[model samples]
Target: MDLAMLLAVAGLAQTPAPAKLPLPVELPAVANATADPTCGNRPALAERATCVVSTQAGVEGVLQAYEAVFTPQGWLVADASGNVVIYMKRKPEGGCDAFQVLAFADGEMAAPAAPAYLAFATIPRDICQAADPNAAAPAQ
Candidate 1:
């Protein structure tokens, strides 16, 4: 390659990558989210990523608060039960990451001691499959 071409190639290689945007974390828990020391690599419950949070808020309060927080970010309430709401958001930029957040309020059991909440989010649905594609043999 010519000298100019070689220099251009090197410059391209050294070009700083786009600034890595901070990966969004669970919201704060002062009526917000407490930082999970695990840094959000939480376990899966019912085939979705999960996290437990402690809050003094009741079901209605939590529903209202989280709706305000997530709705502006384009997440929609996919499903809701009496004390639980499941919010889901697909990557709008056309990526495979689909997050479903399950927020449950259990004040009856956890009350008088500061109610606790559970939230499951950022789950990739493709991993929860019934058939094991990698298995080469049937169970004996």
Candidate 2:
């Protein structure tokens, strides 16, 4: 074969394999939480936050005092005086959930406690449903 033709064929064979690119690693979505007193009264969101706490605690003792309040369908714990002391809420749209630990010593309108927010992406509804047959499936 002609030298030019041989060189051309060799060049084609040497075309470096398409530069391999790290497979687009799809990192799992992470939930970001923050404090927001404005959400104290929101129900759905609150429950979601409390759920995150319940899941994180992974223990019954710390969560024993808190009751699952459905009005806002979140977690609530009352002090010995029977006052709502802690509140938790979730913001699915915001990709986070938050908790409000009330301060009784402080005056009536005490700001939410520090690190009051714990944000986490909502756990896939399917996970809950699959784990518990009674769990309601996420709305389509």
Which candidate leads the pack in lDDT?
1
**lDDT for each residue of candidate 2 in 1-140, tens digit (9 for 90 to 100):** 11121111112223333322221111222233323332233343333332122122221222232232222354232221222233334345432232333211112232333222221122332222244567565799
Determine which window of 10 residues in candidate 1 has minimal summed lDDT: 1-10
TM-score of model 1 (CA atoms) = 0.43
Candidate 1 on 1-140: residue-level lDDT in tens? 11121111112223343322222444545464553433123222322333545454443454466568777877676656543444555554533333444444332343423534444455434222313366355479
Each model's lDDT comes to 0.42, 0.27
Deviation (Å) of 113 in candidate 2: 7.2
Q: Give lDDT for model 2.
A: 0.27
Model 1 / residue 130 / CA error / Å: 14
Local lDDT at 70 for model 2: 22
**Candidate 1 at residue 112, lDDT?**
29
Residue pairs with backbone overlap in model 1: 28-32, 28-33, 29-32, 29-33
State the lDDT at 16 in candidate 2.
Answer: 38
Please provide TM-scores, in order, for all candidate models, with all chains considered together. Answer: 0.43, 0.17
